[model samples]
Target: MAPTPDEQSRTRTLEGVLWMLGSGLSFVAVNGIVRHLGTELPAAQGAFIRFAFGVLFLLPMLVQLLRRGLPAGTLGLFGLRGAVHTAAVICWFYAMARIPVAEVTAIGYLNPVLVTLGAALFFGERLAFRRIAAILVALVGALIVLRPGLRDLAPGHLAQLGAAAFFAGSYLFARRLSDLAGAGAIVGMLSLSVTIGLLPFALLVWVPVGPVPLAWLALVAAFATLGHYCMTRAFASAPLAVTQPVTFLQLVWATLLGALVFSEGVDPFVLLGGAVIIGAISFITWRESVLRRQRSSAVIQNG
Candidate 1:
């Protein structure tokens, strides 16, 4: 007999959780590779090459997007996202080269918190008390990780924070564009725009990169693409609440990778901070899910 709707929903949620796991692993691998590359090349150059390779990988989609005319007035939005994302990418690369993988991963968690704030500020979303409390908790988590006075704040930490902010900006733009275009078009345009945006920075700090670095960057592009695809799959399969908590496992994986492979010391502060940030984000996601369900039920009841 065919599975019931409830059973099917459970199965899809499980599938989405698994997809989130895969997405986390793929991104962790990409981070490991970038860490391995170290400071062998300028961060701008590294970011540019990575996104440039990303463009090549996304060539077919780009071609398709070009063939199908873009939605009106979206060109500027894509360009803006690309510009913001380029900054994020560069800062991320710089931070990855210098910071412990776990720390970088932990700091990056601020993106969602910033995005929540951005939505309220820019999109007129209601900033409820719970959201305000969550945002404050997230800020505390970030402070725990940095411990500005206790430990000398490294440029890497600052860079990662900047990356998170810029990434949030990019996400906000993507959110706007999502209402106007398909995912494929948004992704393809973003990739193309980032490549173009990074061109001058990459050129400004051009250095001869060996073939090995080029190959590794190509692999980075592939894994990054895979991660995005898996994340998209996860979102399609289940609500964000089901998949969001699974991302905390990325900190665990990153910590293990750092300890085992990079021989980096495991910092308890980083782990604790990461947990706090993840918990806050998870709470927000859960609250949103509950609110959404309540709204739907009210609509059904009234109808």
Candidate 2:
């Protein structure tokens, strides 16, 4: 007999977890390559090349976007999102260049926290006491990583923080796009638009990139694209609550890679901070999922 729905759901959740794992590792590889190349090229130019190559993967969807175009307000939103995302990418490269890879990854855990805060602030969602506490705990974790008074603040840390903020903005636009268009259209427009937006900045600071760094940038594009594809697959297969927790492993992989490959010291504070932030975010995801299910069940019973 075929598996029951429960069994199928379990199977899908397992697959999604695996996909998330792959996505995390792939992104780790992409970050490593970006840092490696940052030494040789301008951050903006390198980011442009990476996204320019990333656009090649989205070409299959271009015809559809061109034929239908986007809804009236969405193109403007996409433009705004693209510009914000470009800034985020530039900051990311700059951060990766100056900071340890592990530190950059740890700081990046702030994105979801900022996203949740953004929803509360902009959408008039309730900022419940529990979530507020969670945010505070995560902030404490950030302090552990930064140790502001103990050490002088590095520009790289600030840059990564900025990237996290802008990335949250991009994600907000992504959520809006999901309601307005399909995934292909959303990704295609963002990729193509960001590539175009970066072109001018790249031209202004463009330095001749040899074949080696160009190839590395191509690898960066491939790994990041694949990581995103895996992330989408993971979500398609399972609930966000099911797959989101798996991302915590990324901090582990990034830390180890930084130590082994780059000879960077593993900071205890960063690890503890990343874990705390991941724990808070995971709780928020689980709590939201439970509330959503409860609402659905209530509606069904009332109907």
Best by TM-score: 1
Cα TM-score per model: 0.98, 0.97
Instruction: Give the per-residue lDDT of model 1 (tens digit) for 107-204.
Output: 99999999999999999999999999999999999999899989898899899999999999999999999999898999899889999998999999
lDDT, candidates in the order shown: 0.95, 0.90
Candidate 1 worst ten-residue window by lDDT: 56-65
- Looking at model 2, the pairs that clash are none
lDDT of 1: 0.95
Local error of candidate 2 at residue 198 (angstroms): 1.1
Assess the local accuracy of residue 14 in candidate 2 as a C-alpha lDDT between 0 and 100. Answer: 95
